[model samples]
Target: MASVFNAVDSISAELATIIQLEAPDEISVTKKDAKIEELMVMDQSLLQCMGVSHASIESILRTTLKYKLAFKLTGARGGGSVLTLLQTLLSATVVDKVTAELESCGFHCLTATIGGQGVQVCFGGSS
Candidate 1:
């Protein structure tokens, strides 16, 4: 053990890079107040009803998105405006039910890009 330690100590100090230590800058956002305000407006009533703790909900949010569920209750608005494409090698019946559910929640089921590509679902509504 003594010899091993000596050899390690004697090894040339010349190296591409030595051990690096750093104090990283703070990870922060300046405009979070506005965002938090917006989310509060979006579903403040529902959030109050569900009894969700502030700490847990804050953990899941970033600058762009927030997904929160507490006590088995998903929030008022689940998804947003986007294209959802499902590429199925074969046909099935249940897919219709799925689209119906989306529409009920207010999604516009647009063109089905068939055969060559996946099924494209475009979701949008004023509400």
Candidate 2:
């Protein structure tokens, strides 16, 4: 079990490095840990049901960190969500690809209204 955990951790770290390399220039990926709140947002049971491994979840968490940083740097007002900031700062194709990647990792991205705003991306569940 210990060896399995170590292997998973190693793979997660490698995936994080790849994600950092692929990230947009404006978003800087770091080795800092993700906040508990950010980690809690993901649905663990759903992820398990969708066959997402622990390594994948770790990668997603790292990606979420990058997204949060990008949101803050883009001058998000009144506590805007990361998805909203992404939509505003990135092209539609890029946003779609992000969502698609999330979907592949066992997350579902929904279009929802927030604070009377017409459309926003909500990541949860599985699809």
What TM-scores do the predictions have?
0.25, 0.30
- Per-residue C-alpha lDDT of model 2 across residues 1-127, encoded as one tens digit per residue: 5654465456456545543443233333222223212322332323344454456445655665555522111112432123322422345666676677767877655654323434667779533
Q: What is the C-alpha lDDT profile of model 1 across 48-108, one tens digit per residue?
A: 3445435433322221132121111133356222323232221344456545654665545
Report model 1's TM-score to 2 decimal places.
0.25
**For model 2, what is the alpha-carbon lDDT of residue 64?**
53
Q: For each candidate, what is the lDDT? A: 0.34, 0.42
Instruction: TM-score for candidate 2, please give it.
Output: 0.30
Judged by lDDT against the true structure, how good is candidate 2? 0.42
Q: Which candidate ranks first by TM-score, i.e. highest?
A: 2
